[model samples]
Target: MIYKSMLLVILLLPMIGSLVGWLIGRKSEKYRDKFNILLTAAELLIISLMFKRIGVEPVSLFIPDIMGTGLALKLDIFRYIFVWVTAFIWFLTTIYSTQYLIRYKNRNRYYAFFMLTLGSTIGIFLSENLINLFTFFEIMSFTSYLLVIHDEDEYAHDAGKSYISMAIIGGLVLLMGLFLMYDYLGTVDISVLSHSMKNIGSIKYLISTLLIIGFGVKASIVPLHVWLPKAHPAAPTPASAVLSGILVKTGIFGIIIVVGVIMNGDIPLSTAVIILGFINMLLGGFLAIFQRNVKRILAYSSMSQVGYIMVGLGLIGLLKDHNAIAVYATLYHIFNHALFKVLLFLCAGIIYMILHELSINAIRGFGKHKNVLKVLFLIGLFAIIGMPGFNGFISKTLLHEALSEAHHMYKTRWFDVAELVFTISSSFTVAYLLKIFITVFMEESEEYRGQYRDHLKKRAIVPMIMLSVVIIFIGLRPNVILKVLEGTMELFHAHGSIEPHFYDIKNIKSSIITIGYGCIIYFGFIRSYLRRRENGRPIYFNPSLRWLSLERHIYIPVGRFLYRSSSVVFKVIDRGIINLVIYLSNSLKSLSGIKVKRPTRVIADLKIKKPKELTRFKIKEEHEDITKRLSKRSMHKEFVTFMDMVTVLRRNLNSLMYAVFILAVMIIVVLGVLVF
Candidate 1:
């Protein structure tokens, strides 16, 4: 109970602080900023304590009969690692948001949603059962949507809509998959089922696929990844950090829990996981290489990183005791990726804030303006590129070890495919990350350099420096991370005594190989750079072409065709309604055709009663005078002109009122919504 209380407090503190900060923000910016800092500190402290506690003893807390979840929470080895990562990244993002959100006017609202997302994300990691995980997962989605649409621009709105729509669909599918799992397995606990039951047969595979797709939306797997580029660029920079750095991992976490824990080691399932992961790796990398927008390019790079994690995880599923090694690799990559990705994003934000531009072309000589940032970004670059000392090297090496060690377990053909894809992805990753580095620091653009140089602030330097240290620390002594990884790796059955040559921990040979290849690539890039420099402008390559993009070729076209089809259907429906109205009016006219003749007998009676003798010539002269007066007046023509004038004025007045009412309503609604 004490542990549970502490865990819950750790999760909810940020949320409480965010709300309090939002309320106070209206009164004082000083107080608001202080609240944010305080909340962040508290979160850091709590997470540190959690790490200590989990390190001492693994704890599991279960609350039965809550939301049909039989609410279960655990501080297991796996979650402990994930929680540590989440807390670290969350803290950095909070610090980043302090400055990032300041650019916007109503910053309180942004901070509120930001903290809300943090709370929900924490809950997701802490939840023991699938049901509770889903609940928090949904809360994270909806609140994160608010962050995505924070800019209130048309593009942001559209992206938010797409993101939510896809998320909801994914959530529903996830729920269905979970319910099915529960019906068959009688529980949705993270622990693997002890024995295979009759109820969970072939359907287990189907449900697993559905669940993967559901989580894959957030994971930003290819074909379902349209929202990632749109959402990240639209979000505030700090929010973008969390979205890429942490949020996507929740999807991966879902996959980890479901496939790794629940499925209890199915070979075919693992194979499928590997195949999809390989595809995502290649697809995400190639697509990222083409993007000119800084954040969007980073966003695509995130998908590629996700792909790396997936490949490691899927490989874990394939081998018996090797899943532990894969998990270790996944964890290492997760940590390394978070550090570098956040650094890059925060650096991008600082650049944008200082320069007010988002294009890479605009930041050509960025390295010259902010030398500190250049150094920081370079550290991130090295880490991401799997330099010998960086954290990325540790994970990639482990992954390579897992593959090579499990060579005997996996089929030769598929194993070769995975290896080839991994190698190619690494090459492509180097190309893009270096391309970004070169574009910003090495390129020659005097115009952007001049404009952005003056806006660099000391306030932004701290976060960058902090992240830079982390990247360097992890890079230099990967053993520091490997020690942490071994704790969790002990849970898997890594039984094969086949100590492959790849597991050789000798640094000198690997360093020589890496340096040799890097020199070659560097020279090749320089030659290419010289050629482009001489030619005036560099040629832009499309990465999406290399990996078949469903967005351009399939999704967009299918959407267009659907829109056109819907429009035609709507037109047909409208025409039908118009025709029905016309028919109804005609029917009414036909029904009222009966007419009555009036007063003929009354006129004759009146004439007979007034039977006095009259002169015919006098009567005829009077009738002629009356007929002449009527002819001169032209009553029909006057009536027609008056009716036309009234009709025009009536239509103009109706339209004018409609326009006024619409404008007034919009004004009120906008005020009410934004202010509220």
Candidate 2:
């Protein structure tokens, strides 16, 4: 009974506190900040009290009258991990935000949504019912949208537009899946659905895809990730920290529930996830390499790191009975990523607070003399790049082992290629991180040297210090987390043990190779091409700026096309009805030898200008054609030169289609073999 009450309190405290904090701030802002910090700390303490219950019988509270489908909350080792981390990060960022936002406007409003977002995020982790999960999921989305646009600038508004738009669409899609799930199974309870999915037939694929996409939007999987880069830079720093650290995990949490819990590791679904994971891994890291904004780079890094987590999730399915390592990798990476990624963002926050700028060129050498900030930043950097003796190394090494285990078990060439991609993506992680470190910290600049030496106080620095300590502790003693992760396996019904030899020579060698690749890429390609002399000073440029944007080119154009198509259909229908009316009127008038007066004016009243509309469609069609030609030419210039051997294949349309057909056939064969 006591535990159940605490569960309710844990879920509702932040939400209630959000309102209370806002009310209190109406009279006093200082009290509001302290209240929020204390509220978050209390949240952490409450969740910590439940840690002793791990591996014991899970605790659940069900309220049947809420949200029309009841509110179901559960506490198990799996959910506990996320809830505790969310509390811990939120508490620290709350403290950090107090100082970070001191000079910014609308402190009270920020705190309200900040705490509100925390509540909803915690709610997501605790939801045992799919509907309950989504209810909180949408709330989190809307609340965090406020956080993203807290600055209320044009950039923030634009980011907010993209963020909210994708979120609403993702939610609606997710709701559709839930609707289908309930219609078919008569329940949206996860536990019930887990058992019911096996009997769901082929329709299960459609349900899972909808759910994955709904969750994938938040997970920032490729093509669904356009909002993330913009949102991070536009949001306040503390918001950015949690956005990358905790919020994205909510999406991953849902996916894990769908894949690991409900579907029970369906092979086809797992294979598709692995493919997307690899795409996210490579594409995010590649884009991060060319970014100029620190937050944007970190945003892409978050996407890439989420990819690593996704790959781990997919491997859990591939490894089957021996999936313990992959499970550990997935869960442990979630924990580690939240720590280091948040730490890096907080460090970036400090830099931003000092200079009000995040461009690498503008802030270069600002950390040269700031030893405390530099060291804190390096800890995050080392951890992210998978340096030996860091938390990232532990989880990344486990991910590598999981991939290797899959390769060994199947002996497939596909796994071999995945392993190669995994190694290369790891190198990209190192390269982009080092790019930030060297350019912003190591490189000397006359303009930024000796600036803002003592701008940060204990309030700001302590949170980062705490995060760094946890990161190092976890890195050194990974088994501590691994042991806790072991408790989660029963939830997934996974058996066997994860006994990763963290310091094994093979693992160390893998880390060294990845790091070496990163160093080579950074010093060789990035240094030579990305930076140039401008006005006798070095400037970094983002070549990806010219690259095709998923939002600008794909999503917007498709939306316009749909809108135009619908408009044309409606206009034609209206014109047909009007012409019928005109014909009848003319027949009546002809009987009296008096034509309808001002017939052209009547037609014009409908506002369906045929010539103008036709011209508009023609112009749009021509524009699209030109855009496609430009995109193809850019692609040719950028990549075709590197693949001279494929020149003939590129030019021959028939040959390209043949290659695609063969690839499709190969994939079908692979899937068939895996399924059978």
Backbone clash total, candidate 2: 0
Candidate 1, residues 1-676, lDDT tens digits: the string is 6777877787778778777988898898878877887787777787777666676677777766887767677776677777777777777777667776666866888888888998888888888777889999999999999999998989889889878867976786787778787777777766544244324678888778778877888998866777898899988888898899899989988887666666655678777777778888888876776677889888988988898887777777677764666767777887788888888898888887776677765566666655777788787777776777666666777776677656767557867877777766766667777767777877766665555555556556677788888887876666666665655654444333222232256643553455455445545643354224325655344444466555556655655655565556555654454345334434543565322232221111111111112122233343344334334532232211221222233334444545654454444432222222
- How far is 249's C-alpha from truth in model 1 (Å)? 0.5
Residue 458 in model 2: shift from native, Å?
0.6
TM-score of 2: 0.86
* Pairs with steric clashes in candidate 1: 321-493, 389-475, 390-475
Give the per-residue lDDT of model 2 (tens digit) for 1-676: 9899999999999999999999999999889888998999999998998888656768899998999999999999999999999999999999999999999999899999999999999999999999999999999999999999999999999999999988987887788789899888999999988899989799998899889988999999877899999999999999999999999999999999999889998888989899999999999999999998999999999999999999999998988898888999999999999999999999999999988999998888888878899999999999999999999999999998889889999998999799888988989998999989998888887776666877878999999999999999999999898888878887777897877789989888889989999999999888899989999878889989898888898776666555565556555654454345445434543454432232222121111122213232243343344335434422122211111111122234333444554454444432322222
- Candidate achieving the largest lDDT: 2
Q: What is the lDDT of residue 34 in candidate 2?
A: 88
Worst-scoring 10-residue span by lDDT in model 2: 639-648
Cα RMSD, each candidate: 13.6, 14.6
